[model samples]
Target: MNLTTKILLPLIWLLCAIPAGLVQAQQAGQTKDNPSYAALADLLENEQSREKLINELRTMADETATQAETVAEEASAASSSSRELAQTTRAIAEGIGEQFTALAEVVNGLVDGQVASDEQFSLAGLMEATLNLSLVIVATLLVFMLMRRLIGPLLYARLDNWALHGAGNTPVIRRVICVALAAAVDVVIVGLAYVGGNLVATFLVGESGEQTTQASLFLNAFMVIELLKAGLRMLFSRRYDGLRLLPINASEAAYWNRHMALLIGLLGYGVMVAEPLISIHISAALSQGINTLLMLAAFMYAAIIILKNRRRLAGIIRTKAEQSPMATSKISLHLLARTWHVLALGYFAVVLVLVLLSPANALPFVLFATLKTLGIIVVGLLLSTLLGQTIGRRIQLSPELRRKMPLLEARLNSYVPNALRFLRFLVLAAVILLSFNAWHVLDLATWYASEAGGVLMGRIIAVAIVLAVAAAIWVTCASLIEHKLNPETGTGIPSARTQTLLSLFRSALAVLLVTMTVMIALAELGINIGPLIAGAGVLGLAIGFGAQKLVQDVITGIFIQIENAMNTGDVVTLGGITGTAEKLSIRSVGIRDLNGTYHIIPFSSVDTVSNYMRDFAYHVGEYRVSYRENIDDAIAHLQNAFEELAADEAQKPYVLEALEVAGVVALADSSVNIRVRIKTVPGMQWAVGRAYNRLVKMHFEQAGIEIPYPQSTVHFEGSRQGVAPALKLEQAGERYSG
Candidate 1:
């Protein structure tokens, strides 16, 4: 163990350990032998394997370096994206901070008057502007007050009379028109006031024709606010009750009008006058701040109004709804009663947010949106009302027309009521959606101006045209069928068979038209009808398999109809039930018997149909007479009875042929049966038979022809005791009448 030997041994150990550790750490990949690492020391013993191991090491090292580079590149890219996102966020935050700082700075400038007024204005510019605006307002008010005092009473009286005389579908409608006219009058007053104010601003205030900013602001505010006040008068109309539009009474209307006008005026004046005046002299920030405070105040006021009147107004509306004649109006009134406050609050809240977000143009936008919403609602209501008036609640055909076409009005009514409701619903939804668009809650305006909107509108129009055509075709076909069935149209009364076939045809035509219209409408709406049609066909096949009895009924009925076995209004015997066929359908027959019992018999249940009224019918009479009577005389009397029946106005038309007598039909135990037959029109045989029998009874009585009835003949030899028998006849269960 020399020093040189120890140093060499330690250095060799270190070299061997370093290589093993390097291979294990660097090579994580596995091999076919389940080994991921192989030290150079282990491979050095095999000279041929050494080269392969070296190659494998070189390959693993290269792969490791490539993977690390890829991971580094990915991490670097991720870092770069994150950094960019952070920078963008920081920039947005900084921009917001700068905007806020600017707002604060501009707002602060007012405290020390640091903001520069225009060269045309001075240090006291805001005060002078306020004074000029106040004078113009006073002048406008003076003009309005003078004119109102002169004609207000007379105008109200005339308007009230006109409103009372106005014709409309509903009282609310007529009064609404009157109120609108009244509002127009108020607008005219405002127009006069605006003109006066304009003159004062131009001449008295020495402003040019263009008018200074403050003068213009004041003049515009006066006109807008006064016009709003006038419109409120329509709803209120405390003095002229006939001009009131709302359902509320005069007191409530006045109270609401006063409060709402105050709030509206405050908000309007603040936004139109104060803000603009401040912006002209102080700063835009101060103007915005004032507007924010004004809006908040108005909101608080509106909240108070809602809290005070929510329940009371709801009760009033509930009463009105109960009193309403129209079901739809009642439902709408009830809904509005419940949601009115929520809707009003939402409107104000939206406007507030908008004004705060963009103080420059938001106020004007909100104002215009309010006007647009009102106009849209008014127009929609008018259109729906006009439509309702045109269609009415039910189809009412003239008596003559109804007689000529019994089912035409019924068929029209079947579609009309539902279509009317659907149309009204569509109108209401459009109005609401348009209102939302006006409020900027939706982008309908933008969409309506786009290419897709044009295409959708075109498709909708095409669908409407298709539906219209379908409706016209259905009406024409139905009318023709109805006319054919009618006896009053100069055309002769149709046969029972023809009537039934035509009725069934009309129904089938209606079904086909409806189906085609629906498919075409769905296609126009961009729905694929192919799958729907296939599904329907499959469903029909399945139904046919599952409902064999129903199929049998339909098939049997169709064959029976084709053969003209029976028809509506025919006297027929079906399934042992003798009745008149009141209604005939594809799969069933509705029969009403003499006892007023109605039977609905499926065609499958009817194996036989014995139509008594097919063509001509026979009234066969078998009259029994005593053996002693002459058969020729009895037969002659029967012929006389038929002759009398033929002479009757009611029965004459029923007799088709003279009587055919068959004398001595049979010799009964006590009487002779003489049979006679007479032919009459189909369906009138029963009446003719009844009349003939009555005549025969009368004729037999006059001719002394003994009509022998069942009786027991008593003789004196009866008692069996060789005593005379006495018989007394008495009636049981009989009540004598005077």
Candidate 2:
């Protein structure tokens, strides 16, 4: 490769590429006119077109670099020009606006506007507004001071006059005047406060000058007139018993007045009657309803206080009645007082409930109603019981009978009262039901499957479980005749009746517990038990058959326990075995025989158990007597010994009632046996038997009565044949025999 050739090769390639690019540009123009042709051209000439695009991109790069440098210089000059123009425009606009509005461009544009400096006198409006507000405040303070200094004294004088002249022990008219005066005072206070507040707000928002001062004065005068009107209305319309200053009888009137004042005050404050006087504006309907509720509450409160204080106020009535000309003799105050308080409280409570049920206090009212109902029930029950006790005490009866009769009296008292309460509750419940029915909130059909039913059933189940558990306990304890002296010792052991009752009770309780648990579980899963139980019955039958043996075992255990064939300490023998009875139980019987071997027999297999010490036992043994001894003398001596032994302290506990000896039980190979027997305490036979034997032996030994042993005779057998054969043998035999 030569340099000239390389240069010529490059030059040739450039020439070819430039013409090829030109041809491609022309082809692109042709294709642009016919898009279908362009697609075909692209597919066939893609390589050529790409080469052309690469050459064109190199040219574009060179052009873009030069143009970018020119644009950068122009942009810099334009930005500089724009900044200078913006500053000049801002300064000019601000200066012009300031000249027109006569406001300075203080820091952070606080006061920037256009106007002459002479027009800036408006700034003084701030101070003028302030002075006007201060004057209004001073005036309001003077009004307050005047009311407190003058009106308060006047009202106090009125109340004093009313009190001195008011009727004693009665709701007097003078108290009403006092209430009206107090209401007037409240209205004055509120009006003054509202007017002062309005002045402050108006000053804060208003500009100084005649316009502001004129507005302030007009508002002040209007507010003052409104306040005076409100005060006058409150004075004339307010209710109260305290103005009378009566001793005791002005309770109801006093209560009504105070509560009415409170209600009015509450409404005034809530509605903002003065000073920026923003209306609550919830709705006219809502306002009317609330006012109605407030009125009702006022009445309810007054009634409640009256009733609650009835007893305290009763003396007023008595005093007045005594002072009256018509009353010659004293009245029976007891009956009137008794019924009055109860009736008043009851009526007041009912009214209170109604007041609470009003829309404003629905939830609180419902809760209070429930509490009140429960309280009434409880108080009624107590009152009935008290009445019963009073009557019972007054009636002629023996002291013991009277004391025992409390339970009967209580039951009787409880019966009628509880029944009446229950009936009342039922009526209330029916009303509630009707309310729900009217609301259409509950569908009768779906209620069983709904959340409400779930909650209701849950509470019912909880109460039922508690009652069931209580009933089970009662039944269990019913059978247990606790020996009061041995409560601790006997606690571990079941009484006969206890075992019977506990078994039945526990079984029933267990079944109920399981059923309730299952029901609760299913209920949580949203399953209704009414249908579930029906299905379960079918399933239970199948399961029951499959588990018959288990059922039988449990049933057998229950019956054995119920019958109490064996107890913890009882000794019983069973199943062809002979052993000392150790334990009798529901599941099995434990036995330990003479050989000290233990045996356990199931209750089912324990058909015929021999209880060794069922009720009592006998201690029987024999004493040995010598055959050589005189039988009558020995018997008499033994009898004497037996009597003495019975008197013995160590052995006497085992003797039940008597001890006797049955003569000559047997003639043994070594000694004659004299049988003796005695009735002994249960489980005490063995100890008594051993003690008796010792006593008999010692007595016989002392009496010199020997216990005979085995004795035999020996003779020579050769004597019969030896008569002729041997005289010596016969002589020897005779000697031996002798």
Candidate 3:
């Protein structure tokens, strides 16, 4: 029973297990084949990949954060640098602004007349200054008085005696020393007074007191004026007969003295008192008004003086021009006169502008500029005059120069005054430039610092120096040539071949020098000399190609000249023409024929030349006599006639050798020819031949020698007709008979 039951239950369980297993196996198969199951597995793999991607992203984000922080720190540093640069720029701008503000304040002060308030004025200071100034003045006066009393009379006497007795006999050095001593006496007195006054002032007052400064300036100005006055008096002495330093007429001297005194007084007052007072006490408007009034008064005075002396000035200029031999000097004097008037008007205009339009501070600069310009002009004029006189006197006094180049000396001496005028103009230009610099009209310092200005100025100076050197070389070479080729010495005669050669050499040297100078100047002026030189070479080559005949002519002429083929006055046969050589040039020979026709023969075309009047010449003559006359007798008579000709005083100089008869030279049908030859000096052959002919003729006539004409006897070979035959026969018979 257990086996059956167990088997049945086992069967039931096995059956249930089999059904469940079947269902599970079917589901597994379905699940394995479904698309959704594959999708789920892929989804699981995707989830794992996404987790790894997230971790990588977190690492990248941390690196990005670190980089951002570093960038922000760099940006902050850049901002700090920009702010520092801005601060530096602001500081520089502020500095420039401060400079401009200071300049503006100075201008404002000048315009408002507030400059003097910078310094305080006190009664105690004024009192002390007054007392010190009085003491200085007294001391200066006492010194001046002592000098005048003790030294003046003695110096005056000595000068007077020297002028009366020793001036003419004294050496130039001694005379100059004496004149200098005489002129310096008054200067010494004034100098001593000034020194004493300055010493006293410096001792009494400290160096920086306004009153002391003003007094010292006044005293210095006064001393200068006195010295200038004394110098002017000494230069243009009031006494017409005294030893004067300047060459001026008495009336001119007196006029200059009066004008100079007035000018000096005005200058002293303006410099010492008026300027100080205007600066200290006057308002800008009042100072301008006062300055305008002073300028008007000075202009009026100067204009009146100039107008009054116009005729006198013209006369002086005319006289000076007349004294100079050069026409250029006359022109220069006229130009100077016109320039003087223009300068005066220009000065007046400048003063007017300064007083009316310019600020008060600018007025002082204008005044100072005017004074400096005037001084420069005066110094330039004086130097020009002195240099002109010195050069002229030196030229006149130099015996060697006169002997070497008389004509050149004469010509150069005439140009001395004109040269001086040019020098004065150059100096005036220099002074004007300096004045412009002083007046701040031009920024010369800045301009000079620039490359363009510096290079340009250097080039200009180099060009000037080159020109001057070239001129000096030319002058020296010309002088030497003139001395060597002096026509008066017979060395430079037109007839001399040496002279012609020298002339050509001189011309060629001058052209070479000029060409070299031009090239050098162009190089100095920053020109491309290499290209210029290359161009010149090409041009020269073209010229050489084009002017081959000219070059040939020149070369041939040079050889001819070197060989001494012909001279200017030589009678020569050239280019199939016989004439006297009138002129000789580099490439041609000029000849004037006896018929008054002139011919210039190129050396290249001249194949040959026969100079007739070189050293000696032969005079030959032929005399024809009758066949009956004796040849020996005629030759002897010709010889006698030639001897007589040679014995004559007029023909002796021309005869270098005695006349010789060659006996019978030829035998002719009508006469026998006898040739006579005589040697004579060059250019005298024609005269000697003529004289000989005349003498021979006279001697032949006295000897009864007859000259015969050509005659011929002919015999007919055959008879043409009966009568002609008869006449021919008769003629033949007569010939036979003869």
Candidate 4:
């Protein structure tokens, strides 16, 4: 009904009927009542017993071989006499019948044995299935190989030539060719593996020529291994070529070295995967060990080259820094040290990973361990490179520092960057290891060693040592900041007291963080941490009560910080103490008084705050003029002067707007007073008022307006002496002079 059945029907019938017709042609007596033949016939008793019949017929072939051998021997003895030969033939017939009966018994035992065995997966069934599958696969591959070897090549040849003609640079064509070649290789290699596996399955259980089966299995395995080797070599070769095309020459060289190392590593992996399967064929442990060592040596040599290169760069950078010391950062040396440490760690990681993933080999393991250690040392140099570059990008030195250390510029610019990159690599390594653990491919306990019981106590000690070193560093940094901010009691370093407090605060915080981190890390390592947690809690509570003022200061400081009421250089009056603000820190506020004395006030004491620099200010004063001067005239003069000053080039920049006088503000005893008010720049009110006063003075003098002063006239009549005149005048207008 289907195309496959339609096509296969005729071929099947022809092959089957040919064998049937031959069997039919045999005479009835000649067909023999042999038990072996009867057993074979019984196997085909039902349509479902086709496989059983085929297996039985194949078994009968063995009996036929034995019978033929006996008949040949008897005929040889009777070759000289026909009667003797005929008698021998009859004897052979009786012998053949007996042999056939024995074979039938054997066949029945085999069938019974198969049935008696656990039937989860039958060797007989597997053999039959494998043989059938192999036939189909082989036929399909035959057609595929023909197409690949013939039509595929032909098409490529035409297309490649066409590509060349169309484009001078035929990179596309080259890529296509490369891809095609790779694909062809993959097809052939994988196809062979499939075929080899199938054939081996058939030979193990199928009823066939034992010698032929063994031979086929051997050839199939050998071919598969050869194909795998060829495929690996092809892949490595292409990768090597591709590595040469990178933009950076150094990077390319490094890549090539690393690439070769990886290839060698892959070779080691192959040997490991293949050795168990092929151990029966090749049992030479010494030879296998040698090959594994050789592969490891290749990678070790590559790592050495990369490490050596990194070290050389680091040394060059250091030399450059020394030559131009002014060019490096203030923290250049510190960063360099960190870089070295990280690099060494990374190098060790690479070596360790490679060795762990590789198969165990005696000489190779020793050599790889040595290389790993050496590589780790070199890793520090690599780390320094990135660190140098990163420092260069972030903190640019003052011009003076640059001039002081000229060679340091290049070192900072180059090595720092490499060190930063190395740090990133280390972080990535940790992440990758964690990811492997998550994936169940790696065990975290095994990785840290401290997680395992008993023997891991040494690791715990080492971790403690590391934590101690970290705490020391933290404390040292705190001490430095303290010394910078606050000097000794007798010392006259301004803000020394503040600096000392800040340093103490920082040191305390650092200690707390370090201690907590150590506790957490220990817990992760599965340490018993109950006492540590209790101690920390008690210590925290004790410190909390003792540093209540400090805590309050910090809290109040935080409010100030959040509100942004004042910054580094604002003038503020707080707690009735006014001064120009110098610095606003988390724990305290620094201010310089008007007398130039510095005050470090804790934020807790700063409940009331007055900020002077907000919005605007005012300049108010009273101006006087003569009573003889008209109010309108004085006002007109003041307005003119105010307008002129506002328009002046020197005053214009500071003046936000021109002044407008509010006239006739008050009437005094000596003069009609007028208040003139004007809006001005926020902080420029003083300057504006000053400039206006000067202008108004000059203009009022020109306008002849007299500024009135309190005066009185006294008169004495010369008659009757001064006494009589004083009395008479006092009684009259009360005009007197003294």
**lDDT (CA) per prediction:** 0.80, 0.54, 0.70, 0.55
Error of 2 at 525 (Å): 8.8
Model 2 per-residue lDDT tens digits across residues 610-642: 655667888777777777778777778767766
What local lDDT score does residue 565 receive in model 1, on the 0 to 100 scale?
Answer: 95
Better of 2 and 4 by lDDT: 4
TM-score of each model, paired residue for residue: 0.73, 0.35, 0.60, 0.32
Q: Please identify which of the two predictions, 1 or 4, would achieve the higher lDDT against the true structure.
A: 1
lDDT of 1 by residue, 1-738 (tens): 688965644454333324444465347553545232233344455566566656766886799999999999999998998898787667645644555676677656656657634433356666776677778878988999988877688786787887777665465567667778778878888888889888888888745665778888878887788877776676577777888765467788778888988988899888888888877777665565566678778988888888788888888889988976568778998999999889888888777666666667888898888888977886787667656665575779999888888888998888776677778878888998999888778998678789998889889889978987998798888888878877888569887788899989988887888998999999999999999999999999999999999999999999998899998999999999999999999999999999999999999999889999887999888999998889888888888888888888988888998898877889888889988888989988888889989999999999999999866775555656776655544569655442
Ranking by lDDT: 1, 3, 4, 2
Lowest summed lDDT across 10 adjacent residues in model 1 is found at 32-41
- Candidate 3: where is the Cα deviation over 4 Å? 1-187, 191-371, 390-424, 442-500, 529-533, 536-552, 555-564, 595-597, 604-607, 613-616, 643-671, 679-684, 707-738
- What's model 2's lDDT at 675? 76
RMSD of each: 10.0, 24.5, 20.9, 32.7
Better of 2 and 4 by TM-score: 2
> Of the candidates shown, which would achieve the greatest TM-score relative to the real structure?
1
TM-score ranking, best first: 1, 3, 2, 4
**Number of the top-ranking candidate, with lDDT as the measure:** 1
